[model samples]
Target: MVPMPEQSPPSATHDVTNQPPPLAPYDASADAALLEGLRREGAGWAEDGVRLLGLRAGGTEAQEWGELANRHEPELRTHDRYGNRVDEVEFHPSWHHLMRTAVAEGLAGTPWAEDRPGAHVARTAGGLVWGHTEAGHGCPISMTYAAVPALRAQPDLAKVYEPLLTSREYEPGLRVPTEKRGLLAGMGMTEKQGGSDVRTNTTVATPTDEPGVYTLRGHKWFTSAPMCDVFLVLAQAPGGLSCFLVPRVLPDGTRNTFRIQRLKDKLGNRSNASSEPEFDRTVAWLVGPEGRGVKTIIEMVNCTRLDCVMSSATLMRKTLVEAGHHTRHRSAFGARLLDQPLMRNVLADLALESEAATTLTLRLAGAADRAVRGDEGERAFRRIATAVGKYWVTKRGPAFTAEALECLGGNG
Candidate 1:
């Protein structure tokens, strides 16, 4: 009878999950550095956009979209059901929602959409806040924002696309630019052999009978945002390396020869698609004067480079917020993690760094706004701010991310 004592089941496990999941800050507008800097620097015009992004950044919808889009990476559909080479990449619905929200919030094209003082600063503030929700989709949004200044080098080219690019609506597809209410643009540089040395590109562009028109024949090693309506590509023309505007859909409702060979399986930025595209006699139009592609493309690159700085700064702020949130709820030894002395010191350091980054980024953005209005002092300061801020912030991102992740231990 003693041997008949009840035995417990073998497949039982303890319920022991700890450390709350770190969502975005409850209100990005309430960020001390962000609000203070905006007021001190006379960028109060951007407060409304920042507040809106703040309200959504920590919401359930943003959290779900941020998690799901990255979890479900984009699939490259090189062929259709009937075996036609469509070269389209299919995405989770979450990706589209993220893009639509970002576009409608003026995170991308606000500066170009409405030209005014504090325009770039306001847009930068909104972008920094929105970027905290998700970073991958920001790639296309940033590219579209940066593409404008470069396109302006050719007034004729800018005239056609500016309206679409600046539209608040978010239209995603391969439809004609004329038909779409909003548009996105991508950049194609860095061939397999060239990397950043675009001058070493071997892609050839032969002219058509029509002036300023050409057909490109070459391969792009890295093309960010393949789904974009149009891309600014660099190819060798009779006059040397030149910038050209290549559209996915040609003028006559026909798909161009821009073939997506394959999509890159990246370690990060899983929500966004980067690909190697083969341009087989791809029709394009010259962007700027021949052999001046570097000059024209540099304009675009500068804008993107500034975005890199701002994005890195936003990541730092995001890391601090997440770590701070986790520590406040997580317990260790005898008290809350944030209340402990050693943990407090570490977090204080991170907060200091984040604040510094926010100040510098917003200051630089303000400088850009002033530069456009012809301020020599701000223009000069911007050169130094951009170079130094980008170098310092990006270099610190990886290690900072590691430390912040450790704050939540296994929960991270």
Candidate 2:
């Protein structure tokens, strides 16, 4: 938590007209622009913040995502037991479209917008793209387009899930857009016992060889996104872990073989769904190769992690800016809070640090952009670099948020 600067008493000679009150009038425009922009380009999102901070634009996708995350606060009230929990929150389809536009628009001027048209698809009509999205990196959406090669490269979803994402649905199955309303119902991953450690998972998938031939037999505790059409499950195979593309819906309109065991009542992000589920001979399609389960799952996981970092980081930055404005305008005794020697110094201090964090994040993202374009050296160092960053920015964000909340006083 950021320590609040000392508040001084008002001075006697202070002219009421010279200084205005400190309470920040709610301004939606500023927060909205940054957030809406984040769904576009990362550094570009913080370019405005950098100018304000008097630093260069260097923040990462994580930082930009942090700012956007902050934008959700109005939507997130407190959860006494859960602490900063929100009852409900979701992205509107239009929100995705805006991000896509930002990508195209952003790329026209910047270098990181490789997936402009793809980004546009994500922004323009993402929700409908996939039902019960697995994770954040807009993977549920991006994969809708990205995994196409993997999807079509093999006979996998090419005849199945592919058409669902595009305007056409290959004759009989769920459509993408309507899939959004399909409420996942449940998921199938691991438990406290293990997550990525699929080897420790007790869930089992049996083979029947009846064309699509498959059956699930086991319990999946802590499947993260289980609120849609069904799930893409992973289970231990004789050779190793295997990923099965499982559907939540069945032919008779009956629930799929999967059943919800419980919903985790989380502390911070109550709006995001997390659950434990059971699968009883559930029908499914194997994704990628049979024994290559771990590899396939990583693809999905990577997508979510990226999106998560962006969203979390976006929230933090937005909160930081709002707090700064609040402090700058509020006054204690004679002068505005921002005019205080201590407050000004701290604000200056925060400006440099936060901007530095933002820039660093962006540079990493740019590096990531280059890397994805195939830049390689010592891969290990990149993660080491990421660790250096995640630690700094994530920490400072909350500190800034705490300061901002405190700055708002009882109003917060």
Candidate No. with top lDDT: 1
List runs of model 1 lying over 4 Å from the truth. Answer: 1-18, 21-25
Can you write out model 2's per-residue Cα lDDT over 1-412, one digit (the tens) per residue?
A: 9999987677854656533343222232233333333344333433343233212111233234323433442122123365632222244333333223322222111222234322321221112111111113232333332233333323655565444433211112232323432122122557557875766877776777664456878887776545335356677665567777776665555446656555566665433445566777777777667777767765444333333333334545545565676776677888777788977776766555545554454444444443444448523444456556665666666677676667556766
lDDT of each: 0.85, 0.46
TM-score on alpha carbons, each prediction? 0.94, 0.60
- Backbone-clash count (model 1): 0
Q: Candidate 1 has what TM-score?
A: 0.94
Per residue, candidate 1 scores C-alpha lDDT tens digits across 1-412 of: 4588776676554554556654544775568898777766667877876887877876778878988999999988888899988888888999999999988987776577676778788878887777777789999999998888888888898999988887778998888887889999999988999886899999999999998899999999999889999999999999999999999998898889888889898988889999999998899999999999988888788778778878888888887888998999888998999999999998998888888988888888888778878999998988778878888988988888888888878877
In angstroms, give how far residue 387 of model 1 lies from its true place: 2.5
To one decimal, what is the Cα RMSD in angstroms of model 1 from the true structure?
Answer: 2.4
Query: Model 1 clash pairs?
Result: none
Off by over 4 Å in 2: 1-155, 162-188, 251-254, 364-392, 395-397
C-alpha positional error of residue 320 in candidate 1 after TM-score superposition, expressed in Å? 1.1
